[model samples]
Target chain A: MSKNLVGNHIRKLRFNHNEMTQQQLADKVGVTRQTIVALEKGNYSPSLELAFRIAHAFHLPLEEVFFYGDDPTQ
Target chain B: MTYQEKKSIVSLISAILIFGFYCLYMYPQYPGGGLESPEAFRFWGSFVLILTVVSIVAHIVISIIFNIVFRMTTREKEPNFADELDKLIDLKAFRNSFFVFVVGFLLAMGSLIIYQPLHVMFMILIISGFISDVTGSATKLYHYRRGV
Candidate 1:
């Protein structure tokens, strides 16, 4: 499968935040757990509004939750 | 598999079964006159119309049953609403399904241009509709398993 450029730290961040479950984060962001699963697996890129919602769920800035390349900026 | 994947598979199977059983049930009722007979046309018309209604109602019933069964078996409630990912996947599935039906429609029309019998056109159209339904479900299954 081709790689998706839009990478996210949702999985790690979810763990950092009291080991939040996929369902919990999904509820926080107003999405299904399947969407969170897809994001963690790099199988989907969220729309801007959804991305913002996810970021907000993590209490992080957009860039802190998501990155545009294979590697995150230091 | 996730609920979406299971639902997609159930849908695909249901589409095939519904079309197959409907065809089997209706096959013997075809008019015995010439294919071009008005009675033949009437049979074909009612076949398509009744099939449409039957399939729609059957699908709705099957979906409800599937959801109930899924919740009972998995002990998890199905998602209450569609989210962005669900909508996106649905759009993609619809696009593919619509494309298939359009192609099939054109081919069916082209068959008439080639001097094929009217019954041939009717069969083609009916088959196309069934295939399109299957395609939509299959597309959803593929994307759900492989991710969109």
Candidate 2:
């Protein structure tokens, strides 16, 4: 199994999508901008529901956004 | 920082200050035994009064700062275990603090047997609890800062 649970180049994607800001995406996803920043920075992993919202916002598949691995906190 | 992070930092700092005052000033001035010497009575009475006043003032200051910055209350509610990550963090911190508390409790028990003084044992227990909580949060803060 893969150990690299790290995922996403959300900042890159945002830039590709016309300089879309973190606040804009967070508003669409019903979370605060700090949460979006945390997600983008890989400091936080979103809930499945939040993951779906993020993927939906980007018009992409969930696989393109996040990946699973052993609990990092463990 | 998230609300939890802000609240944790505030509580840790407040505890450090409280403990700092106790160790630096109160302990040295405290009388040797639990007897009612004039110095002991004066210091103990003032300590009680200062503790009450400091606690009330600290709560007000921390409450206002936390509310403004993090939208938290004085007696903050237990965090809603909203996600797996949060639960994991909580568990790690809780376990660490519990271990610390147990060690402190054992030491206090041993000292109680030797000194035969309930007051000394109680002080040890109280200090132990505070130290445990502060260290637990400090660990969590380290993880949070390291982008866990």
Candidate 3:
């Protein structure tokens, strides 16, 4: 099966936001740290609501936080 | 690990151990015995009662102990909420477990057609239900560890 290719800048955003920890971001977004870790690892694709929530946690536009592409390696 | 993941692990272990013990206890008594037999009926009746009590007690104790240990080690209070991702993982795990139950049900039906033993059918149903629950809990734990 083809792997899903949703991508995110969460790790970078966290770094930029004064070295925010995964747990901190999770608390901000009302999710478990594991969910944030999964998103960072690209092992799961979030629902639209979660996607918006993550973006809101970082105070960024949705596109700036997440995007769809074929090359997740990038 | 999350609280739900820890709970699932405990539940899966408990189910396997309890069911294994039940099978061992019943095996010697099951040969040539039908459900209508007073001895078999009484054994099953008491077994069900004991299993119910044991399962409830074990779950409560394990949950409390794990919660205490987790809080002590992590200094983070246990999260009581199931977030959107956790709910989605639960749904996915349930979908995977539903197929296991369907297969078990089909096998039980086939056994009913072939053997036609009421006691055997009942045992199959009970075991199948437990297997489904174990599968669901295991799948949830796996997803929690491996990501979902």
Better of 1 and 2 by DockQ: 1
Better of 2 and 3 by lDDT: 3
Cα miss at B88, model 3 (Å)?
1.2
Error of 3 at A14 (Å): 0.5
Docking model 2 quality class: acceptable
Model 2 vs. true fold: TM: 0.64
The segments of candidate 2 whose C-alpha lies over 4 angstroms from its true place after superposition are A1-4, A68-74, B1-8, B22-60, B66-91, B113-116
Model 2 residue B144 distance off true place after TM-score fit, in angstroms: 1.6
Candidate 1, DockQ to 2 decimals? 0.69
Segments in model 1 whose C-alpha atoms lie over 4 Å from true places = none
Off by over 4 Å in 3: A1-3, A70-74, B1-7, B22-35
Local error of candidate 2 at A18, Å?
A: 3.8
List, residue by residue over A20-73, the lDDT tens digit for candidate 2: 988688678776655666677677766778888888888989776665664333
The candidate, 2 or 3, that scores higher on TM-score is 3
lDDT of 3 by residue, A1-74 (tens): 23348888999999999999998998988888878877888877898998999899888899889989854446
Task: Please provide, for model 3 over B1-148, each residue's C-alpha lDDT reduced to its tens digit, 9 standing for 90 to 100.
Answer: 5666777787799778877886677678653545677777676677667767776786788778988988898798887788877898789879978888888788779888997776676677667777787888888888776766
Model 3 chain B: worst 10 consecutive residues (lDDT sum): B26-35
True contacts kept of each: 0.59, 0.27, 0.50
lDDT of the candidates, in the order given: 0.91, 0.68, 0.80
TM-score ranking from best candidate downward? 1, 3, 2
